[model samples]
Target: MSASHPDNAPAATAASAQAFQTRLADRAAAMETTLTEIFNRRSAAPPRLLAAMRHAALGGGKRLRPFLTVETAALCGAEAATALPTAAAIELLHCYSLAHDDLPAMDDDDLRRGQPTVHKAFDEATAILAGDALLTLAFEVIADAGAHPSPDVRARLTLGLARAGGMTGMVGGQMLDLAAEGRWGAARLSPDDILHLQALKTGALLAFAVEAGGLVAGADADVQARLARYGKAVGGAFQIADDILDHEADAETLGKRAGKDAEKGKGTLVTALGLSGARAICDELIDGAIAALDCFGAEADMLRHAARFVGARRS
Candidate 1:
């Protein structure tokens, strides 16, 4: 295996990421196609509802979560083909979160990824169903993928995704976020508290993404530990960058409505730490994430690039 982060640590410019992406760009594109097809064929689902789901999911984004799954699996010596379903399943779960998060009852955002939100594109009820369908379908995708592995391994993967996507993880984190809104005075959230919240809300699923991918690839315990640390650090960095973007990025560039965090009175790393401080924290998390890959050797360069992408992505 190659070093996950080269001592040469090439600066992660868009040009650099694009170059590294070129290495696996074809594979990633193929995975996206397969993932889209799989998502479109669920349960002979209503065409309109299915269209809504596809619309929200297929639109452009970094696809970072799925990439993490596939890339981590590859580094662990698992074929990317074998990990495709897991990657797709994680993306579905992520899409579902974004769908729900954009609802009238939630973030109430009209734009996502430079397009109307699911609820806006379709109707609220249809968007709700679309999100629910994706959430359930994610489990089904994982379960089907697990069938290819030994029964025990399959069971473990199912359990890992379920735990991470369910009440104890992503959903739970959302609940905490809802409660934390605009209560910064009495609640008086500290930076640590904010980090913990983001870790659960945004980082838990990502943590699960890396760990589950490693498990599927049959990585050793040590490798799994490294992957987990990498995921957590990268996940935190992703959210911190999100905060920075929300603060400073423009709508056209971010692909989502900017300044919603401040508009909603949401407490974030940006609000808690000032712009420069938040940016500094993002840099720190990127370094931490790269350091976590030190044991993986050269194979981890893509993962390092991924961390850079998370820290610096425009959208």
Candidate 2:
């Protein structure tokens, strides 16, 4: 890593990658533990539904959304522990979305995170209920006193999540996506339309994730704005990266059906702009995301690293 030894530049890069992965894994583990405890306190609920809920929420993945929340909170001078409840809440909401998205009426996916999806493992009704329960419990987690001592913080986080996942957010985007696909005699979407849908469907939650930390830390408006911008760019990059992977990666590598977007006639950045153009947009988003954090110093390095890592997702 010594600058004097330029010959080891590649080695240094590899070391840095390893360290970032290690850091990511550590944060993911912490979030997993919180989720485990939350799911464990449901003895009164029906056993099967609880199991299905657990299956949906506890399934293995990168846990990136919650990781961003915790990391952004840390960068804004909040303790990771203090931010964990909100982080876990966001993760639960994310899992709920995935579960519903994989339903026959939605994305109709059979696999998730390399495992049989909730509907396939259980039943469609169970999967639906699990997703519903997870979504409802997410609010409960965020509203709980444990999420933040200040009632105002909890309220703001709750409202933010509602707006992100509600009619004007993910739900609206899903509707737009279906319409764009001509499911009900809808028209074809232009590139701008696709971008707007993506911002609502995918970017909203991520924007909330990055901003959640600041809310937890009581960060000023300017810091919150920076995190919001960073989160938005990162979310854009993630979707584009995923679009590229869907075309390039196989089922085994992607943990789900590949090229489903194309098969379903979905309009994506890739479909609209082609592979090279989509990648260029992704690169620009990553650069902008990193630039958004320049207001901070070395403390924001992990976030900058995260922007690249998220964009780099592939087979």
Candidate 3:
């Protein structure tokens, strides 16, 4: 899937897509193993807390964010081993968000990944603790010398992860989402507003995933900026695709509650753009994401495939 390939070359594109999927699967399995070992090493922790953490973090979703981290590192010529801990940290933070998002006070979902959510499998308190633990542990993982040889690189990863997960990013976006649910009598937001909110909530950590790879590779500022842009674009596309899936897919397919956005009157671009229009927006973002990778040429084929997959994924 070189950038020079003709647009009409379906065979090459198909083979590239297949290769990307295989790589994604292999990376995800490796991540699963790494996470399992990390958790197992926490033997001194309370048994129930450890169980709740494992329930939330292990045997999970596509692990796309971590894949992005590892792949982006590879794109920058870093070894997979050097990126593994950082990738695991991102997944831990993501799982923490999911745990909290599924709480009774939040989305109130009973299912996740076709299994009972942590709150349902354990108690709400345990689930909350698990999320908190995961969130804190992410910092520890990033701070460890194993994540990067350079102390400066480790610091950069820590600071970046903090900003992405903190009040200005994911948490801020979550607050805005709650307000948009008519809590502040603003059930409908402008497209720009939705973009801003989603960019913060969903896009921030994803951007970090890409940028963390750059940090690990000691990439120059220009390269890091390009990868950040690519990540934000793909992240936006991912959320739009999620909105479309929520409207069209069943709970069985989603592995969680479907149509909750509409049910709760949560304002999304889908409300303003309708299904077809939302799809168009996603396509545009995907194109932008791929374009952001133009500087990397063939080295970015995996990322190009990732952007497309985010937009077109069924779940």
Candidate 4:
């Protein structure tokens, strides 16, 4: 059959999507193994804290952030194994965020990844300590000699992740979200305001995934910049998709509470723009994400697929 035949297009598209999913699953599984190894090596921590950390991080989830790190590094010509430490570091930080986010003082959710949240599974203080330990452990993983051969690279990765996880990024965004909920002061946020909040909260760490990948690969400035742009675009699209899911999906499907955004009066793109408008913006971000990858060749197709996947995902 002709490769260009119209009859083959649908089959080709399906095959491509399947291939992307397979690759995503493979990377996700690899990241799970990496996390396992990390825990195995650090077994001397307090038993309760270790149990809470393992419970909070180990069970299930897509592991999207780590996959991004591995893939971005591969695109820059680094091996998957070489990216594992940095990737694991990012996942540790993400798990820490989730543990803390579900604390009584925060979102107070009872479930995560379809299981009891850390606080519920353990105790409030243990959960807090677990979160704290996981957060510090992220830097520990990234700073290891395994992450990179050079001190310069290690330092950059450490500094970059710190900024991404700190007040200038995710923490700052969380503060703004609380204000949206009237914890400090309530105010109606415009679309731009929502974007800013999401950019800081959700997008910063995501963007750093690729930035870390580039740093790991020792890619030049132009490549790093392009990866950063793609990461930011995908981060924006991912958050919008998440907001849409909260509006439409149930808790069972989301593996966590659905519609908490509404309950907390959190401002989102979906709230600022209507659902249809939010979808439009999501598509635009996906377009921008793909465009950012034009500098790379076929090696970046997986990334392009990731952007499309972000826009169309249901949960």
Clashes of each: 7, 0, 0, 0
Q: What lDDT does candidate 3 reach at residue 303?
A: 83
Q: Which scores higher on lDDT, 3 or 4? A: 3
Instruction: State, as a TM-score between 0 and 1, how close model 4 is to the true structure.
Output: 0.95
- For model 3, the superposed segments whose C-alpha errors exceed 4 Å read 1-12
Better of 2 and 3 by lDDT: 3
**lDDT of model number 1:** 0.81
Q: In candidate 2, what are the lDDT values of residues 1-315, reduced to their tens digit?
A: 113223311333776768878989999999889999998887788999999998898858888899899999999898889999999999999999999999999989999989899999999999999999999999999999999999999999999999988878888888888777778885778888888998888888888899888999999999888998999999888888888999999999988899999998898989999998988888888878888887887788778778887777764
lDDT of 3 by residue, 219-307 (tens): 89999989988999988988888999999999999999999999888878888889988888888888788888878767778888888
lDDT of each: 0.81, 0.87, 0.88, 0.88
- State every prediction's TM-score relative to the real structure: 0.92, 0.95, 0.96, 0.95
lDDT of 3: 0.88
Which ten-residue region of model 4 has the weakest summed lDDT? 1-10
Task: Give candidate 1 regions above 4 Å deviation.
Answer: 1-16, 23-28, 145-147, 183-186
Best by lDDT: 3
The stretch of ten residues in a row with the least summed lDDT in candidate 2 is 1-10
Q: How good is model 3 by TM-score? A: 0.96
Give the per-residue lDDT digits (tens) of candidate 1, residues 12-131: 456766777785566568667966778656648789988998987885766777778888888998888788888888888999999999998888889998899999999999999999
Q: Which order, best to worst by TM-score? A: 3, 4, 2, 1
